[model samples]
Target chain A: MQVNKSDLLRRLKKIEGQVRGVQKMIEEDRYCMDILVQLAAIKSATHNIGLAILEGHTKRCVSNAIRSGDGEQAINEMMEVLRSFVK
Target chain B: MQVNKSDLLRRLKKIEGQVRGVQKMIEEDRYCMDILVQLAAIKSATHNIGLAILEGHTKRCVSNAIRSGDGEQAINEMMEVLRSFVK
Candidate 1:
């Protein structure tokens, strides 16, 4: 399934807000632990988005390739992406 | 700066081969140091792809948002992705 650009944009907007909030907290001298906690939450959210995108790619592009007898190619591509993603 | 899906797929395929090679190495009881080095290379490649995507997003989507007066939202979304990405 193709990802909706608008939907992605919307989610990104929310994330941007969260980032700014963190910056504000830092500027206000918020507790270090609190800032770290917020940072952790943001990291989780980001990873979730990555997983979602990866899932979508697997379901749509990769699966299609496999069905078309390009499974090896598809799997390879995914590995490449995963390599970078985990870094 | 839209990413070409085909290009992405091609790169992924290469990465897949590398991963399989790594697996094979492990199965063959290849030197641990050799395997670890390959693993590190894979990780770096993966992160590079992510950065490429992120740069594209920033240049295309995020920048567009800013130009269109949705800067706040765009930045937020990017931050969200970054949070997870670093984790």
Candidate 2:
């Protein structure tokens, strides 16, 4: 499951803009509730982008590794990422 | 500015368990791609938790600072976090 690189990048760029907007809202003394709403939106966008990448990894990298008998190592690598990701 | 502490904790705990599960999958030599899928799920959960916290901060902490004319300081704190977050 290879990722659609362009689509992922576009989503990431949109999230980046949203983050900047949150910062600007704070600087402008925007309403607290509004800022919070923006933050939530950004978070949701980020999660979506991560899911896209993860989907690709599962479809392509992981499957390839399993077929090549490198499944254990691939799993270990993913585990390492998950440790930091959750942290 | 106050978070629903219980909800945040519940989400974090779930993600923690997911991370542990990913590790176990690796230990058990579960399917490589399946492990990757699980890892992605953990990442998504962790992001949601982070968003919850960030929302609380914006609603409570940032607003409070603005009312007290500490808006600059509060914005700076958030910026610092964004720096690391986007990195």
TM-score top scorer: 2
Q: Model-by-model lDDT, in order?
A: 0.72, 0.59
DockQ of 1: 0.03
Which runs in model 1 stand beyond 4 Å of their true positions?
Answer: A1-87, B1-3
lDDT of 1 by residue, B1-87 (tens): 125767777788888999999999999999999999999988877777776676556545754565456756665676568556656
Candidate 2 local lDDT, B29-53, one digit each (tens): 5654465466456546545555565
Using DockQ as the measure, the top candidate is 2
Per-residue accuracy of model 2 over A9-83 as CA lDDT, tens digit each: 455456546555655554566654465555556555545654555566767887798999999997787667656
Worst 10 residues of 1 chain A by lDDT: A58-67
